[model samples]
Target: MMAGMKFLSGKRSIFKVMGLICKKCALAIMVLALIAPFIATTQIILGDSKSDLEDAKKQQEDVQSKLEETKKYIEDLQGQVSDIQSYISSLDSQMETISSSLYELDLQVQDLEATIKTTEEELAKAEEDAKVQYEQMKLRIKFMYEHNDETYLGMLLNAEDMADLLSKAEYINQLSKYDREMLEKYKATIDYIAQTKADLEADKEELVNMQTNLQDQMSALSLLQSTKMTQLTNLNNTVAAEESYYSRLEAENEALEATTRQLEARIKAEEAAKSSVTSYDGGKFKWPTTSTRITSDYGDTDGRSAPHKGIDIGAVKVGVAGDPIYAAYDGKVVISTYSASAGNYIMIYHGDGLYTRYLHCSSLLVSVGDYVTKGQKIGLMGTTGNSTGVHLHFDVRLNGSYVSPWNYLSK
Candidate 1:
């Protein structure tokens, strides 16, 4: 009987121990319940990080699209860099914007990284706690399973009254619900962490691609700028040479005018003898150079002591040589010769006292007295005379006096 009484005493002790375990389990479940909302808040923050990354990508995409347009627009230069100053300014503007965008994006990425770091630490702690809570729950379940009958018997033996017994029973039932809920929460935390990690990695990769794309755009722009700079340098040199040419052009032109008048006297003598030019059909003169880009107009007097005598038509690419010079009208070549001031020149008489002269040819195609049709390729544009750059100096004379070529030019 004494041994039986000792056994009951031990059983009561076990009941007390089990009651303490149950209390600990309840505290763990309550802690999980409280922290559940915090984890949900963290999940929302993670979503916000994703949105910020996406927004940054969108901004870069916009800049990238504009760069593409710039790339295409730069291609329209067609071997010439004319009017390149304006385009260079445009490129500067675009680069400024791109630089600003990059700075802004970098700032945002830094902000996101800090935010993610803090949030990840919190999430990792929460996840570890949830795992611990789950482990505790499993241990409790195994203990209850191993001593299922004894656990309930201990509860009954330990209850002080009916109210207490019912309360303990209800508490045990609530623990099962806590177990299920805590398990779900733990799974959710793990999933959120995984998704956040994936998003971070993908965002990093996309940022790298954006950087590479920007580099390509910069390279293309640099190439275009280099080409334009070369053209600009050539143009500056040519302009200086042209200024020098104009300084001595007036004195040189006086003698040239005399000689040209003498040549015309001979041509008129031939026409009188029915040996040279036929009567003109009367039409606007053809543009004399393959390129209609005029470097100097007929009456351009800027930086010149006297008005420029003829239009100077340069190649499409400034300072480039070997482009064709064409005949202004159907005429007989009067004199095809080189002189100090008018190197490799041509004089054409288009009857009715109209005459066209081409100067600074690299090589003359027709001989003196050769009849040529209008728009014929008469020579290659060059800078052979009192000139220093490749171009054609075209003149129009009516009755031995220089006239405005613009008056006879169609365009």
Candidate 2:
């Protein structure tokens, strides 16, 4: 009985030890399985972090390049503003001088009117005197014709002696000479009066024409003044209230200059960043349409003489409304919209303050933030906005402002 009890106790101890060893082995296997997954996850996390760093660096470089370009644009705009201001100042000076000249012309016209009136009166008096003299001369001519033969015959028959006959002949010659002289004097007076009247009438007609011309000139001057006043008002409004337009212009210029300086500073900072990073170069650009006759050049003034900032190409050859429109440059789609004024429109950011716009599109093939390469199909053409017919309203912009699209594209 004692041997049996010892055997049973030994067997139980061995079984317990075996179970403990098996439990340890299973725990070791479980730990290894769990640790393997963690190792794989760590590797994946490291790879993702590296990729994110690379992406961030690339984005930073792009931002830097854009900042540099924006600075250059701001500088150019500031210079243009300065030049416009100088031209406007010169125009104002010219306007003042023109106003003074016009005032003097008005006084001259008034004086001419008075002279014309006096000349008219003088001409009327001269015409009446000429009529009276003409009538007196006609009566004398009739009387001489009626009595001259009778007198000559009677004088010849009544001659008593040679001396008397000679005296009568001298008297007849004197009378005839006197009549002839009087007739010539009267004709000369009438001719002089007619000439004077004709000259006065011409002078009066010229004065009337001068008055009409003066009135026309005044109307033109008034229009010019009104236009100038409107332009001045606009300039003043744009510059705000500075008491003097010149002073206001100077102040606005100063502000623009300061902004330009700040932009330059930012550009320099971006340049430094770009130097350390690999830049993501933009893709090649493609033609926006197949049609290529430019009906109007960019920045051309229309019939109203309104300045046109975009180029107008002939769209008659191209298919309307559903004609594929391609991207002109590599850019990210920034805006896609439809409005009553712009119709279906799309804006693409070509980086560095350079943007392109497609207007009057019948259809849009892109959304905002879609990165596109040059020559990629984008939209279609249609009649939209302030358009007479179906045409693509294409435009190029530098730093959020419109510029001549022709400058960037070939015919």
Candidate 3:
């Protein structure tokens, strides 16, 4: 009975040691999974962490692009405002020139009026003199016709000498011709003065019309210039506001990065507190379940040729649909979704900005925000979103970029 008891005690001791070894092994494997993404060149397992990091990176990139585009838009708006301001300045110059021209036109009109008045006065005097001379000549010609025999003609005829008769006849003819020519000359001068007055009136009317048209054009230009100035001011204000907003966003992003670093340090300290285990030593790692070989390697070369971010582990024969999918390590469940390309997907945010992704699951066993333990069931592997058959799409992410998971796997 004592020997039997001794054998039983030995068996019990061995079992305890084996249990200890298994626990340690699992812990070490988890540690490697957490650290390998950063420290080593490794392929990633399709998991939640990888998806979270990738999504964050994509979001950051999109925001950066938007920021740049906004800057360019602001610059364009500024340029447009500048152009408007320049146009306003040009309008101001044009207005000044127009005002000056209008002033000159006013002076020209005044001078023309003065000249017209002077010309009219001179013409009126000339017309008065012509009329007086014409009346006097008519009176003289009529009187001569009525009294010619009793006047100079009669006297000249009365002279008996031949020389006197000839001189008297020539003198009468000269007087008669002088009276007729004076009447014609006075009429012609009066007609010329009337025509000059008409021309001055026409010139005054034309000058007034030209000045009115110019004033109308200047008024329109002034309105346009004022409108452009207002638009420019508004645009400048908009650009300033946008620039300030972008500045704030940049500051916020920096703060977020700092916070992320601190969290990673805390996670690292917590991980160190766990006791050491045998599984930490390099060896063939037991598959989380009896599963088929991987059908798609990490960073697969075919199709799209962009670096494959994860591996595809096929479920050939071991499990039925809706079977439990276990967590490879302890981590927080950060995201879960039925994504088009990933099917039912989950992203786990681990420490140090490391992340993992799991996809193509039939159903999720754990909700987002759940704290999972190592080997905890998180989902059921099955063909789901963007999947061809029953399999698991797994990934690893570091600082929001996809990395190889193979480097972290213990097997």
Best by TM-score: 3
lDDT of 2 by residue, 261-288 (tens): 4334334433433343233354434558
Instruction: Point out the worst 10-residue segment of candidate 2 by lDDT.
Output: 41-50
- The whole-model C-alpha lDDT of candidate 2 against the native structure comes to 0.57
Please state the error at residue 217 of candidate 1 in Å.
2.0
> On a 0 to 1 TM-score scale, where does candidate 2 land against the true structure?
0.32
- Residue range 70-166, candidate 3, lDDT tens digits: 5776676667666667767766876787788889889888988998898888788877877888788788779888996788767686978988888
Between prediction 1 and prediction 3, the one with superior lDDT is 1
Candidate 1 scores a C-alpha RMSD against the true structure in Å of 34.2
- Better TM-score candidate (1, 2): 1
Instruction: Highest lDDT: give the candidate number.
Output: 1
lDDT per residue for candidate 1 within 1-411, as digits (tens), equals: 332353355345435534543554465356446534532332110112224344434433433443443333333322223445665665566556556666766776676677668667867887898889989998999999999879988998799999999999999889988998988987888788767866876676676566666655556556555655665565455444334433333333443344444444444543642356667777989988878888888888998998987788888789888898889989888767776678888878888877888988999999876888989988988888788698888888776577899888985
Q: Which pairs, if any, clash in model 1?
A: none
| lDDT measured at residue 359 in model 1 versus the true structure, 0 to 100 | 89
Q: How does candidate 1 fare on TM-score?
A: 0.40
